[model samples]
Target chain A: MRVGLDVGGTKTDAVIIDDDVHILARTRLATGWGVDAVGATIARAVDLVCGEAGIAREDIRSVGVGMPGQVAPGSTRVAHAVNLGVRELDVTRTLEPILGIPVRVENDVKAAALGAHALHGSGSGTMAYLNLGTGVAAGIVVEGQVWRGAGGSAGEVGHISIDPAGPPCRCGQRGCIEALAGGGAVAERWGRPGALPVRDVFDAADAGDALAVALRDDLARGVASAIRVLVLTADVDTVVIGGGLSALGDRLTTPVAAELEAGAEASAFIRSLRLRERATLLPAGSPAAALGAALVGRTTEEVLAHG
Target chain B: MRVGLDVGGTKTDAVIIDDDVHILARTRLATGWGVDAVGATIARAVDLVCGEAGIAREDIRSVGVGMPGQVAPGSTRVAHAVNLGVRELDVTRTLEPILGIPVRVENDVKAAALGAHALHGSGSGTMAYLNLGTGVAAGIVVEGQVWRGAGGSAGEVGHISIDPAGPPCRCGQRGCIEALAGGGAVAERWGRPGALPVRDVFDAADAGDALAVALRDDLARGVASAIRVLVLTADVDTVVIGGGLSALGDRLTTPVAAELEAGAEASAFIRSLRLRERATLLPAGSPAAALGAALVGRTTEEVLAHG
Candidate 1:
């Protein structure tokens, strides 16, 4: 058996899976802030999940935690997980002795990518999980293994500038994909307070508000560009869109598809790619992140060097 | 000994290498039009290179050919090699019987990427070869193996639109990296007849021509965008610029480096990536394409699957 945890900014999701990857138990808890609190939260969640699974802690073979941050390749230390309010944390050191299990850590988007591939991929090709969260990023999985690039910055597509005149990005560029499509960027551009700012923007666009309509279009354009980048650069078989904004479902995917179709209409090269058919939305509330964490915990080596 | 051939639009470069990858002999010949002529061209090049090496053709273990076209994964058939005046050709069918040796085919840019990594890469890290040819494209090599993406369009970064409002591309897109920096596109934009139109544009820009200045800056911008795309999407350890236009050397790399530096100035995030340091220029007349072809010929399996 293996245990997995998705330590999010607001919540911690836990799962217990058997050898065949069957989910034996699942639980969620509100996440706490900072290092020690976060560690304690993981411990509590682990215990709760074990109880829910009706198994002793000794039954678990390994634990994996996925979070929004930089997890160095082949290491359990996470850094700059701003969303989780974690500056630095050694996940193995924090949880291994307490749980008496081997521990591994991976970036949340990467873990989700692995899990999504397991659930939705063709089982024999490359897939990119494009996360549209507070910041935009992607995680690529090839043949079921997450691509852990040099310096661990692979799939930082959010910073690729698509337009010189588009918009100012917080990353100091103009017209970054994240600047246009990220949930936080859109909310800031909308200048409106709402629990679901992206959903509100979509609703206002439906009502024919000019700015809302423009933001909505920009979101679609950014997403379409990201799809093109993923296909052209990595040539993944499909792009699975997930993240907070994905909750909009068809409201988001429809326009993004339209944007790709529009580009295809103008360019025969783009038309031939049949990009629209290759993009799909990850079902909302999928346990991909935690499930992927469990899978990751089982890998002996996440890095490969070819001679 | 292994034989490698770069069957270009105008010239066919051939090389013979020993088991240690040491070049034994190198020769070039004018390529012919049509399928039969191309087949004859390869045979002639092989004979000529073997003579140059003072070795018999029977000693050759395998022959790998790299050309501009679409090569399906693990296949020796090439499609849409327009510059070579061939719509479709099965290289293995045409050459194997003639040579009595195993023949492997690969895209020129992809071959060059593998070759460049072998020559200039850190050997164990990922690298991208950005080919600034008549059209812009990139080939990514990870751990010394070319990343042949699903469906074999893995490195077609030329069509990625970096500026929607900047310029129209032959691919029917606006502001594609190719449209801005491609040798063909820039010459078309310049509308001047010159053997080396890109170099002419650079020289004219140095002479203070307004149109030339704009075109030159666009080339730099396009190249910079391509480097960024490679780094951000694939996180290549370095981007080695090659292809026909790379002959401009410092006139090309200097401005491209400046463009990357300019982006770093605007964003601390860009600064952290050290993109300028990662961008490099392949040496003039480097045998990367043919060498990479030779390397590809030796691989028993270019594909992998994980479960």
Candidate 2:
């Protein structure tokens, strides 16, 4: 069986899958987000996932882990992950001994794109997976492969300057889409000091809360702009929304679709590109990133290349 | 020998290339911008180029042509070319009878990308050719192949809205980066009627005219944003500036590089991306599109696919 691990800011998910892409077992646990904690958490989750499947850790062919940061090309060393406070962690060396198997690492968003495309892509052409959770970014799939880009930064679109005069992002840029529309931004703007979750904020907006209404509208606009940028620039055949905010589904896409229509009405080129028709939502409970991680590395060379 | 033709708004350039990629013959002439004028113009250029090479049309392996607009896949039928007042013209069908040879068509900017990569790319990875002439757009090259996005709309980044409150573009969109920075927009903003060309706008800016400085600054910002978009999203290894504006060279890139440095100072991710270092200027007067168009088709299937 193959092992896939997705390490995020709030959760660490692990899965075991057979060659046919069937999930044999899975595990989800809170992510301890520090240098030592991250490594331990991933190791525990891997052990727990293997145990659940009643499989020996030695039986696993390889471990593929996806993290939310820059991964050194051809290695599992994570250059940095500001959110998780990870710096220069060599995942391959650290995990290879514990698991007694080979390890491959990739950026979380790129892995998610690969997963989304593997499960949902028809293999017709290129597609993008837009991840909206604590942060917003996109992973691009070209010709059935993840476009890792020159510096391994292909999918990092979270900090694009959406509004030059808007609020500042954690990355020190101002008016980024992530700051205006990501779940973290929404929670922060609600000013509830973690008392109100992102879902609660959305629920309040649905119930006619005045501030929630405006914030929701702005969020929709930011998401809409993100979609436009993806469609207009990359011209991907489909854009699947994944990550945490994906659970919101139509409540988010409805506004986004409306915004697209409004823009298309004004621009013939936009209308011709058919941006709205290409937007899709990931399945409700599937671990897209983990599955993608599990599915990658059909060969050792490919695994290293993907890393 | 291979033949290439670049059909532009103002001029048509043709070149013949030997198997060694050396230029055997070259020709340039004014292009009339109507439907019939476009076809006849391309036909005349082909005839002139062949005559210059002292070869019969039948001796030419294939003729490749690049134009600015949407080219129907597998054919030379132009869907629309507003700048040239041409629509639905089948370049292959019309030019084949005139030139007595096979023909392939591609977007001029995309062709320029191929040409630029062929002439300058290190073959390390993806690269972009940012053409700033009558309009602003990009042509992406990956692994020495043009990446025509899923919808064949790849590298068309001109119409993206940079500022919601900015001026209007010819495409009926408001505040597009093209409107803020493209040659057409620069000429329009310079407001000297036919007296001031785009080059003159830069000249006035260099002479320290107040409006010219502000416009030049805005153009630099728009171009810098274009670079950021290319780097952040596609992560191309290098971006070579081409087209009419490329003649300005450092006069333009100095400001654009400055803007990039300012943005990088604010965002660590941007700094790490090394967007500034990745930016390069295409050498002056290389006839990138013509050369690319000439060397584009080595096989019938490849030619049709490129079309």
Candidate 3:
């Protein structure tokens, strides 16, 4: 048995699973702040899941946590995790003693990609899990392993600006896809004066709200550009959409697919890319990040050793 | 000793090298038309290089060819070499019987990437060879191996449109980086009625011709975007600039470096990419593609096996 924890900006989710990855138990709690709060929240999830599974912590072979920020490979020390107000913090060392198990921590998006692969894998080949959430990022699976680049920053496509003449991003850049496609950006642009919540922005577009429709189309373009970048650069077999914004489902995917189709119509070479065909969606209500965190340690060890 | 051949669109370059990759003999001949001419061109290169090196065909261990288009892994059957104006040609099977040695073929850009890694290798790590020439493309090396995607269409970044409202590309696309950055595009935009040769375009820009300056800057942006794309996706340690257009050298690299520097100033996240520091130039007069071709068979075998 193993344990997985997804430490997010808003919530901390946990899961305990058998050897075959069948989820034995699961729980969620509001994510706390600081190293102590973060450590306490993680400990609570681990304890609750262990109790629910009716298994002792001794039997958990590996416990993995996926959190935001730049995490050192194979260790729980985060180089920087601004969202969690973490910097150079060693969460693993703090949690292992409390939980009575060895723990590993990785970047949250990367863990989600692993989880998506483990549960809804296509057997073999590459799959890029694009998380369109509060922030935008990707978890790139090259073959069956995560492709952590030379600086441990392989899938940092969120900040890659597609439009030079577009709006400025909070990442201190102009025209980033994240600035254009992330949930916060959508809410900020169209949810002003509390007129349209981000949740109803899509429904408003469906009801023919001009501002909402334009914003949604902009989001689609950004999403399409992300797919194009992933397909053109990495040639990933599939681009699975995840994260909070993914709750919009077909409303988000359909227009993004349409944008790719339009691009293909313009270029035979771009048509060969088949970005639309390569795009996919995570199943609804999938706790992929937590589940993926559970397997992060073993997978990271195997991949780093092999790579 | 091994024989390597780079079958380019305009010329076929060949080299005979020892085990340490020391060049013993080298020659170039005009590239030919049709499968028979193409096969004959490769055969002639082998014959000439062997003669110059005072070695018999029997003494050679391996002969490899690098051509454009999609090459199957460890096989010489090209899916389609548009630059060569040929499709689905089996060059290896055709040459092996005549040469009395097994011949392997690889994509030209990919071979150039391997060549770049072999010649100016940083021991072991990812290196991206951004070929900004007649057409724009990249050769990606991950852990001393070529990263051929599931469809063998990994490094076709030329058609990745950076500007949606740019111009029409021959690939039936609008606003591709190639449309704005490739040598052909530069010539088309600025070359007219003895205005400037493609070779003199940069010199004219240096002479302060407004038109030439604009065209050159456009190319710089495209090249910069390519580096950003390569780094953001693969995070290669160093990106070596190669291909015919790379002959411009610092005139090309300086502007590209400047563009990346500007992006860094705008975004801390972009700064972390350190694109300028990672950008490199292939040594002048280097026969990287041919030499890389020489090592292609062995390297391809190792990588595909490992992958």
Candidate 4:
């Protein structure tokens, strides 16, 4: 069995999968902040998940971790995971000796992208997993491998400015896709004190609130622009929307589709691309990130041998 | 010796190269309009270039032709070559039987991208060849292979709209990168008669013409955005500016560098990218496109065996 863990800001999701990736057991635990605590949380989560599966630690072949931070290509070190309050952490060094198994770490978004590909990929071509979370970002998977570009920033489409006059991005750009569509950006712009501000904004838009309507429209526009950029730049076969905002489901996809439809109606080239048909939403509560981490643990040499 | 032909709208540039891709001989011929003439032109150009190199046709290993049309991935067929008045043409079928040499065709921009990579690639990572001809387009190369995305529309950054309220494009979008920076678009917007209107616009801008200054700024803005998009999305190590507009050399790159510098000044993240350092201009009259086509004709099997 292989083990995978999604180390998020508030929670660590763990899963044990068999050879065919069938989940043997799954569990979740509150994630701790900082390097030491997060490391401890991972250790505890692995123990709990192994217990849940009624398996000995020796039965686990390898462990893979999906972290919400910068995982450099080909390295287990994660850096600047602000949401988790982690300045830096070398996951392999911390976990390998304790677990007595091979370990690998990948960025959460990229891990999810790999999982999404395994779950829903067409078995060929490319798919971009666009994360519309606290800040928008994406991960491109081509032929089952994550496209980690030269500087390990291949899918940073959120910073691409579509509007020079729309809104200022935290990245110091005006009218970035994130400024228009990010969950945190939307919540901040809505300026309402609510745990689910984006959901609230959507609810208010349905009631014909002009401000909410505009905000919702911008969200759709930003998402549609991201889809276009992905298709035009990377020419990914599909863009699977998966993030905190995607939990809204049809409420989110419908408007984003409308925006794509509008662009199609305006341009024959855009129409030919059929962006609306290509954009899709990941199912709510999917364990893609965790599942992908397990796959990551298999190591490059093992994958080559097995496949 | 390998033969490469760059079949453009008005001229066909042909070159003969040795095993190391060094140019041994080069020649040019006026391209004829339509299918038959274009096919004939390719045959004649190859023969002439071979003769110029003092070699027999049998001495040539393969021939590659670059066309200004859509060459579907892994196909030798060229379609919708409006610039050359060709609606459709299977370049290989037309020439292979006549010349008795293996023939391959690729889009001009894509061919140029490969050539640029061979000429200036860092020997690792990725590079984007941004073409600023009558229209703006780019072709990305990773390692040594072209990144032909799923639908083969990868690197069509020209049509991506940066300003919703900017100038209208022939593709029915407003504020497209092409609309702002394309030679054709700038010429139309400038509305003055000249063989080289973009050059005139620069000259006028230098003389403090208000309209020219605005046009120049827009051009820089469009190019800068393209560079940013290439870096942010693909994380290419460098972007080489080529095509007709690059003939302006420092006149064009200077303003483009300034725009990147200004963006870096505004955003610390942008500064971190060091975009100004990454964007570069291809040398004038470089034989990259033809050389790339020659390389392309070597075929997939050949590349695997040789590399």
Question: What CA root-mean-square deviation does each model show from the true structure?
Answer: 2.9, 3.4, 2.8, 1.6
Candidate order, DockQ descending: 4, 1, 3, 2
Candidate 4 lDDT tens digits, B1-307: 8998899888898999887768899998999988899999999999999989999999998999999989999997999999998999999898999999999999999998888887887755499999999999999987677888888889999999999999999999899999999999999999999999999999999999999999999999999999999988888899999999999999999999999999999899889898998888899988888888888756556544543
DockQ of candidate 4 against the true complex: 0.83
lDDT of 1 by residue, A116-195 (tens): 88778864469999999999999999877888777777899999999999889999999999999999999999999999
Worst 10 residues of 2 chain A by lDDT: A298-307
Cα TM-score of candidate 1 = 0.97
- Alpha carbon lDDT at B72, candidate 3: 70
DockQ, every prediction: 0.82, 0.66, 0.67, 0.83
lDDT per residue as tens, model 3, A136-205: 8898887556787777767778777777776678888777888788887888787565533556888888
Candidate 3, superposed: residue stretches over 4 Å from native: A191-197, A299-307, B191-196, B299-307
Q: Indicate whether candidate 1 or candidate 4 has the larger DockQ.
A: 4
User: Which parts of model 2 have CA positions greater than 4 angstroms off?
Assistant: A30-33, A54-59, A82-85, A207-210, A299-307, B299-307
Summarize candidate 2's per-residue lDDT along A229-280 as a digit string, tens digits.
7766777788888988888878878877888898888888778878888888
Which structure is stronger by DockQ: 3 or 4? 4
Question: How far off is residue B253 in model 3, in Å?
Answer: 1.4
Give me the displacement of residue A270 in model 2, in angstroms: 1.5
Per-residue lDDT of candidate 1, residues B1-307 (tens digit): 8898999999999989887677899999999998878889998999999999999989999898998988988888999998988899999998999899899999999988877887788644789999998999999987668897877778789999999897899999899999999999999999989999999999999999999999999999999999899889988888999999989999998888889999999999999889998888989999988888877756434312100
Model 4 chain B, poorest ten-residue lDDT window?
B298-307
lDDT of 3 by residue, B1-307 (tens): 8899999887999999887777899999999986778889999999999998899999999898999877776666876777777877888788889999889888889988988988786644788888877789998888767887766557667777777667678888767788879888888888564433556778888999999898888888888888887888777788899988777777788888889898899888789878888888997778999988887767545544432
